[model samples]
Target: MGLLVNDLSVHGQFADLGSFAEAIERLMVIRQISLRFGRTLHCHRSLAHARVTATMTMPQAIQALAFEKRRAFMLWLTQHGPFWEDSRKHGPDDWIECNGSIVTDSAVGEAAWCCLNGIKQSLVSLTPSSWEFSPVPVDWVSNTGDKKSTGVVNHWTPAAIEAALQAEPAPLISWSQLDALAIARCTRLTFAADAFAPLNGLPFVSGAAQRLLFVLETLNRFKSCFDVAGQRTPEGHEIYHDFFTGKKEEGGRGALFSDSSDEEKSKFRSEMTFQHPADNTMSLFCSWHGKVQTPQLRVHFSWPIRADEPVYVVYVGPKITKQ
Candidate 1:
């Protein structure tokens, strides 16, 4: 449930690059869901090829679809084309009739593979050359468990997967492969409004603030332990962690959750570097922020911007630290 394989279940059916692109756009722009337009095409054609072509045109077609209907189309497409194809291959073209049953079966499998390949190619092409400062990036990074599909399909109900592996031509992937690829794409896209645009009225805050707020809210609801704080130096704001309760600075904002009740916090501490100071730290914690529903608060801090990091992340749990 918390891996990339889960994400691909949504996008693997796209027959070609076109539908794949449309699928991404639909999810990113108007809320990620199964779209309506894709379904009519899937139901009418009962095949991935036709579904793919129809999906490719969805961006424009969506303009005509009611905002509410878009999700229906996307969900229908997900439930129909890709799912069915992965479950089992279908009949072949007339030309293949001459070939023996075995050869024809091989042909169908080949077609399915090709369709999946097209989807992979399309997704890679659609990747933003670079991301601007946004809350959630479109693709998932390994740090956050978001994996891209490199033709490795790992999710085939255990029994089905076992069967596919035993089949001829040594299958390269399973249904689960699509899940990871899809999540990878999602992780890459940032969900935050483009810089200054918050859906409601407000300053829209800063990326750091938004991220810290998410962490605090999650811990509060779940009753998990965490520490967070920001410090101003002659250089800039340093938003480092104190791990366990340590000697407090003469003047400092204690970690978000630490209180007088807990005199000594754990000694273990760590730092999470972002792709950019502007990229913020929260995106690194949750694969995507907006996807989570909680409070609307942000953490403000001054830190050196690091672009080379490209979402660098580190984790340190409860551990004893010396002074």
Candidate 2:
């Protein structure tokens, strides 16, 4: 489970990764991936995001990323839509560490935050390379829309994730514990909210049952940039982008539908209608680090998908080398 945000350099709102392909195509790939975030990321994923820098090649940056990431990435690529329901629950303190990220089991709640950060501007590659797919930007984090995460959700366990998979209906909003796990797996944020039930609708508004799905998809996204095993590095490798669809705009949540024909607008409206089920969502700016206020809810804007515009496959990181 994870949160896809706009440009991490400047703070932006949360964005759905539903249109993974179309949005990624427009991302600016540069040398330095920025680690600056609205909240602290898991140490392992933090390590992943920090690997981005202004000077290193994509491959040089994600050198230490593990293969489990690749496995997670592949699983996510094969599926579509929110993955929060499938996120993994863990021991009270299970955590992953990386030079850039420090993530643990207990702290994960609410918004899912997980991604690589701290590089140059969007879509600007530092050194020209021969990689087929260009490096686009994506990050991750965990969050909670309302309640404190208790770790255990509806009796679902880590073992459940590995076995007995059940089909989840379209995401519905509710105050289920899985939502807690989903919030934790996606991104890490400190915010306050009143107790309420999540209404049915929207991408993330649905119950947090998609946690495992988030983990799978995020790992895939994580793997795409890192490509730890050098399976498809530096050239026209399909590994970079296997899970993107132009559906995020189908909903009214994004900025892609601003210019459209009457018929297209109608279709867009028909497709759109889901809003996040929770409300009173606000950004928490903390000052204890002194006093500050954070804009909790925001949308990360990116170039919309255009019928006239052609999409191309591009790699987002340095080429991985065999050890």
Candidate 3:
């Protein structure tokens, strides 16, 4: 995901130069968190030249900072390459229809541009008196004259960005992309180094990767609950059943699944068993699975028994059965 620093958000009064510099520190913290989740931060190409206060441009304000602070800020700017030039190529001027209302606020225009361009905005609010750049909901008209809400240009404060780090990830279009990104993209879950290899030979289905992600997320929630309250909760299978049945909502999402029967598990124990990556100990009889049918796909995983451990995925491929 890309987080664009709203240049408009910085064009306001601050209590002091210190306060403005503090906001820059907050922005840097936000950048660190964003980078942890494989997200990039961006600023408009014109932001460096834009006036942050009545008399100071963004570069001027940075220059006014103490020597060490100025050097650090300059280093960060060079590394992140904040300035983005493609935003103007999208014809941002035509995004918001006038509808007989003259819309002249550059901030609102930029917000509309972000909305149309599928970019998230980060505000540089320095003080309590700073103006809130609220989300702008725009109606987009299709060539057929159908009007539809094209989503709002929502901006995140530093706190909001941190809060959203664990939210459900956006779906990917291919299994290869999902396999490459599953661990980083799914913040709450972990994967075995060999887990994705089996999936490489399998054919891709339209929504199989997304369904697999949902299942993984649900399992992550189950593991989290078990870690916090393992003694009081039911066994792993029972809790897993509740999650898939929608009976439990503590990070649960209803999806399709069933535990392998005792006969099947006994017959295919070797097939179901896998070497644990961390300890190289065998994780036996990973019978719990989430299934996607028609083409028939299955994700086989084991629940964590220890505290602070993640739900471990062992296999993702065609459903294994005794032929």
Candidate 4:
């Protein structure tokens, strides 16, 4: 998860040393909470030199902090120092495509740029009045030089940080925690109990579980769209194309899907047929497959004729026979 500290909020916002110290404490707590959930706090490199009050820079403020608070703040800075430095390397233009507008060179604009490009966690701010730094829609300029409103960027004060972290989606499940039952339960995708047996014999490959989950999730989403619309929408096809070409990067892993070649399907008809999960007497030709190329993992499933019926995964393992 990505959390960008609004560095501009740190400068000259505090009323006194006491409030500045309190803000530091809040930041430390936020950092600890983020770490517990496997996230890191990032700030622009300029934060190190940011003024805590009109007269005191961050370093000076740190020195003035109470002993225990100073020690903890220093440690947090030390641990995340490199991340802050890295953030400095990229400018707002790097995110223009995603935001479709020019971000101001100011601190809040930098935070907005980060949020637009997948650093979507809340923008952490020092003072309660950091709301002032929240940019209005009018602040953004479109590529054609027309004013456009960027997506709502969430500005999180110290009080709201914990709740925001708790609301984030659950972490990805590991390969060791993955199984056919888990997949079915997590995705609500239906398949026979024996459909996943092939997975038991396949050697474990790095990122296999993640890749498999992506395929299942994509298939489940497509099923949902079909159920709602009775036909695939352009948006649905765009999603399919992204996964089909391994272009969607946010999901667990890259996947490519295709139908079996006619020659291969003809020769391996028996190998591709499996008992339909919805009906024991009926067998379906499970020729459509999603695959991970490096380790050659394949998941074959049937595309049901009826919109109401779910896709039935019939095989999961090595590639089926092909000439």
**Which candidate leads in TM-score?**
4
How far residue 109's Cα lies from its native spot in candidate 3, in Å, is 5.2
lDDT of 4 by residue, 1-323 (tens): 35667665675777777888777777777777777876667766566678778788888878768898787667656554535444342244432322334445544565544333223434666664444454433243333343323443444555466676687765544443456434655464676677667767566643455556666666766666553658777766765665454322322233357677798889999999988888889988888897754456678887642366677777777778744
> How much lDDT does candidate 4 score?
0.60
Ranking, lDDT, top scorer first: 4, 3, 1, 2
| TM-scores for every candidate against the unseen true structure | 0.17, 0.19, 0.44, 0.51
Give the runs in model 4 whose Cα sits over 4 Å from its true position: 1-4, 35-46, 51-56, 80-93, 97-120, 132-159, 164-173, 178-182, 185-216, 227-230, 234-323
Residue 281, candidate 3: C-alpha displacement in angstroms: 49
lDDT, candidate 3, equals 0.57
State the lDDT of candidate 2 residue by residue for 90-119, as single tens digits.
222222322234333312211222222111
> Model 2: which ten-residue window has the lowest total lDDT?
286-295
Q: Which ten residues in a row have the lowest lDDT in candidate 1?
A: 33-42
Q: Output the lDDT of residue 103, model 4.
A: 41
Cα error, residue 213 of model 2, in Å, equals 3.1
Looking at candidate 4, what is the lDDT of residue 124?
A: 68
Clashes of each: 44, 113, 0, 0
lDDT of 4 at 111: 50
Tens digit of lDDT per residue, candidate 1, span 20-134?
5554553333222112111111121232223223254444444444566656555555553333223222234312211122222332232322232121111111122121111
